[model samples]
Target: MRQVDRHPGKAEIPAGELWLVVDSGVKKWACLSCPGGCGVQISLSLNPEHRPRWKVEQDFWRRPTISPSIHQQKMCRCHFWIRKGQIEWCKI
Candidate 1:
């Protein structure tokens, strides 16, 4: 996981399948690569003004957890949540 001001900035968006990119602190955006290995990047908005946004919480383990689930309407059709630094996929 990497904290960046801009996507693909100094960071390469780690090649790890489950890599995360946090932009402008934890409130700007939380991005991740699609688990489908389709080389697509997913961006979750944290801006309150945005119609659909996600919230990130920290567990006792300091692991990042995302709520309300992530559903991709396009392409791979992946749906899941990140809890305790793990991806818990929901039935698509």
Candidate 2:
């Protein structure tokens, strides 16, 4: 996935029909979809104190992209995916 800065204009990141990575740190979550386009949201907390969970409904969708692939999409470095529990340590 391409990394992007989390500025005022850049908040939401859509991860195709697979998943959408949201937020950072131990309490991270990704919005997923079933094969038939059914929404299946799941969250995973890398920290032991936190719990890995799943949500049925999420706010993730396919955003308009100039290019087809996510790699070709323009994004800020801060908007990329960081390790589940190590997001705080990530640097742009």
Candidate 3:
């Protein structure tokens, strides 16, 4: 998927897509349609107040670079990481 800095509500983000929602220039959070075919909206904070948050960076190509990893403790329980615009699944 591609990266966008738009106000989340204004964009028609696709399913299983990654969206970077920000306020002004500060990244507020990252969101995506759950990749496990659950169709649930998974949102992770980039704010310092939330623990175990993630970060995102984008290159000129518009692809995204996400850091650390993402682990869903809830439904589907998917675990993976996005690095340099590629999703790397964790063998969990």
Task: Give per-candidate clash totals.
Answer: 0, 9, 0
Question: For residues 1-92, what per-residue lDDT tens digits would candidate 3 score against the true structure?
Answer: 54467646645457757877767778888888766666566677888777878778778886777777888767888888877667788995
lDDT of 3 at 61: 82
Q: Which of the numbered candidates is closest to the native, going by highest lDDT?
A: 3
Which has the greatest TM-score?
A: 3
2 against 3, candidate with superior lDDT: 3
For model 2, how does the per-residue alpha-carbon lDDT over 1-92 read when each residue is reduced to its tens digit?
33222221333334343233444522233332221223332232223354433322222342312111111122221222232211222233
**lDDT (C-alpha) at residue 49 in model 3:** 75
Look at candidate 3 and tell me the lDDT of residue 62: 68
Which residue pairs overlap in candidate 1's backbone? none
The 10-residue segment of model 3 with minimum total lDDT is 2-11
Better of 2 and 3 by TM-score: 3
Q: In candidate 1, where is summed lDDT lowest over 10 consecutive residues?
A: 9-18
Off by over 4 Å in 3: 1-13
Predicted candidate 3: what Cα RMSD to the true structure? 2.9
lDDT of 1 by residue, 3-70 (tens): 56655533434443333445545457777777655656777877778869888777787687888798
**Winner on lDDT (1 vs 3):** 3
Clashing pairs in 3: none
